[model samples]
Target: MQKVTDYFNKPLNLLPNYFKKIGLGFILASVVFVVSVKISGIHPTAEKKEMMKIISKDVVLLGMMFIAFSKEKDEDELTMLIRMKALASAFVYIVIFKIVSDVFGIIDQELIENKNGYFFQMMIWYFFVYYSAKLLR
Candidate 1:
């Protein structure tokens, strides 16, 4: 038990700065790809739609991977604590949003038919909120 507690209490390991930069690049690439796809107005054949969905998900996942692994500024105990808090807050916010949306019928049913879409969106918002909270401190 002592060993386990000591191991878990060790300092955070932050990724190199380049990871964040690369993540931002991948995010930008995804946005551009999506915009181009929308602008092209190609008819959505089954395979094409599937391809697009996969590509979109892949890019976003790649970006998320990089970002999640990247270092925060002054990556220390305090930052880690803040990150944990931010995640908790983001989760609560999303839960409330979900409840309100469901109660008020504010969201489209088809859009949330698959919970993955909502989860992905919540993750994106989670990072945004975390960064915002970090900046405010």
Candidate 2:
């Protein structure tokens, strides 16, 4: 049990800090592409639109993963502790969101149908918690 706890508590091998900038670039590019397409008024066929959406979402997810895995400028014990706490909080938030949405039917069925959206929401929640905790501390 102690070993298991230690393993779980171990800090992850994060990517280089520079990856955060690359991730931001990816996210910005995706947003720009989408906005450009929309503003250009080039109405693609339904299939094309769906493909674009999937691609854009994938790019955004990739960017987010990069950002999440990249190390902070000063990676230390406190930051690791805060990261873990933020992750746990985000997980709890997702569970609560799922339960409440299911019980109240507040969320759109379409959004729930897409796992990418669900995972994206989790990432968003994690960032929110992580940044807030860092700032507050």
Candidate 3:
């Protein structure tokens, strides 16, 4: 037990698990969003804008829970700045990717059928940024 714990507590191992927590968070929130849609018997895509408004809050709560824990160890100011830059880039990329996919008509229902679309993309982006940060460091 001690050996296992010691191995993971290494800075390297801790990083992946931290990002994995982010993935789990997106999955949990997505499940709630999908289940809510099914149980409510409201599949109104026309009302989708309103639906997003309702569930948008869940993203915040999930972020607070998952991302808050990812910062378990104190980082140096330089490292923190690098992370902030990475986050900004991640945000821009998500926005641009979503827009381009929508505008170019490249995506279809399969990718987003159950709000899983958002969650799926989020997982991919988190890992991209997470690993990129690791490599940059």
Candidate 4:
């Protein structure tokens, strides 16, 4: 463990095109292959295309997160506090929306079609609250 720590303390250089050099290509190939098989409607395949779709979506999300996390910025205490408040406000909106949906469901189940859209609405609410806080501050 000590040797490992010592090694990590030294500066290290990554090989060029490390993601390409490693097995990411294999992952990409499998994603493509499975999708093609699904499109061709081959028999004896146990809906592996669904799994491939999920994996591909996860890869996209991971790639996006790399870009998001790579950006460097500084936030002051007030800005951090405002962000927390904004998040809390969004959570409150989520709870309220859920309660309203449940009430509507009791009244009529068809009131809320496409329940998955609630996530997108919540995201919009977060930004609304965040900017509202900034303006009020």
Candidate 5:
């Protein structure tokens, strides 16, 4: 049990702090592009629109991954613990959300079919929990 705890407590090899800024830039650019397209009302063919959605989702997910794995300005044992806790909390939250939604038929079937949607939700939860924890500390 001690060994298992130690293994779980090991720090991840995160990206450099600068990558966080890069991640933020990616997210911001993706948002700007999406907003501009919506405002311009350039309705492409269905296929093209679907492709655009896929591309935008991929970009956002990539940015989120970069942010999730990036190092903090002052990485330490407490930070590592907080990160672990946040990730676990996010995972549990997503699982419960999925189960509840399925049981209640609250969300669209298409959303449940798309794994990326769940991933996006999880990332959102992770950031929320992480920052909230940091602020409280």
Candidate 6:
């Protein structure tokens, strides 16, 4: 188990310098997908809308995951610590956001309907927060 954990923890230079671009591309693709769905002349059936939602969610999540796991140019103890801190911070923020959003949902149904938007926002926040913490550290 320890060996498996260690292996999983290893950051491969596999992503190199292109991780950010690839992640950004995924994010953009997610946005474009939603926009296209909205603008398409065909009235979206319930199943189609659901499918699009899942696809968009997957795209955003994949982008964020790519960014999160990507190897930095300088992979050092300090960078790893910063990454861990950012993850902790993002988790806390997500919890708080969810609670607040839930409270707002009691006041407005629209808030509940837009729950997926919160997920997308959280992914973006995680990506930015990781870099921001690194820079600030």
Q: All models: lDDT?
A: 0.75, 0.88, 0.59, 0.60, 0.88, 0.77
| TM-score on alpha carbons, each prediction | 0.72, 0.84, 0.43, 0.47, 0.83, 0.70
Q: Which candidate do you rate higher for lDDT, 3 or 6? A: 6
- Candidate 3 Cα misplacement greater than 4 A, ranges: 1-65, 72-74, 106-116
Pitting candidate 2 against candidate 3, the one with the higher lDDT is 2
Between candidates 1 and 6, the one scoring higher on TM-score is 1
Query: Model 1 TM-score?
Result: 0.72
Best by TM-score: 2
> Compared with the true structure, what per-residue lDDT tens digits does model 2 show for residues 1-137?
99999998877889999999999999999999999999999999999999999999899999998998889999888888889898898899888888876765654665455545678989999999888888988
In candidate 6, stretches whose alpha carbon ends up further than 4 angstroms from where it belongs are: 1-17, 36-42
Determine which window of 10 residues in candidate 6 has minimal summed lDDT: 11-20
lDDT of 6 by residue, 26-133 (tens): 989999979886787667889988888898989878887777777787878787777777777777887898898789989987776866666567666776877787
**Cα miss at 127, model 3 (Å)?**
3.5
- Between the candidate structures 1 and 5, which one is better when assessed by TM-score? 5
Local accuracy of candidate 5 as per-residue lDDT tens digits, 78-122: 888889999999999999988876865654665456556898999
Q: Candidate 3 clashing pairs?
A: none
Error of 1 at 65 (Å): 4.3
Report RMSD (Å) for each prediction in the order shown.
Answer: 3.3, 3.4, 11.4, 9.8, 3.8, 3.6
- Winner of 2 and 6 under lDDT: 2
Give Cα distance to truth, residue 34, candidate 5, Å: 1.3
Give candidate 3's whole-model lDDT: 0.59
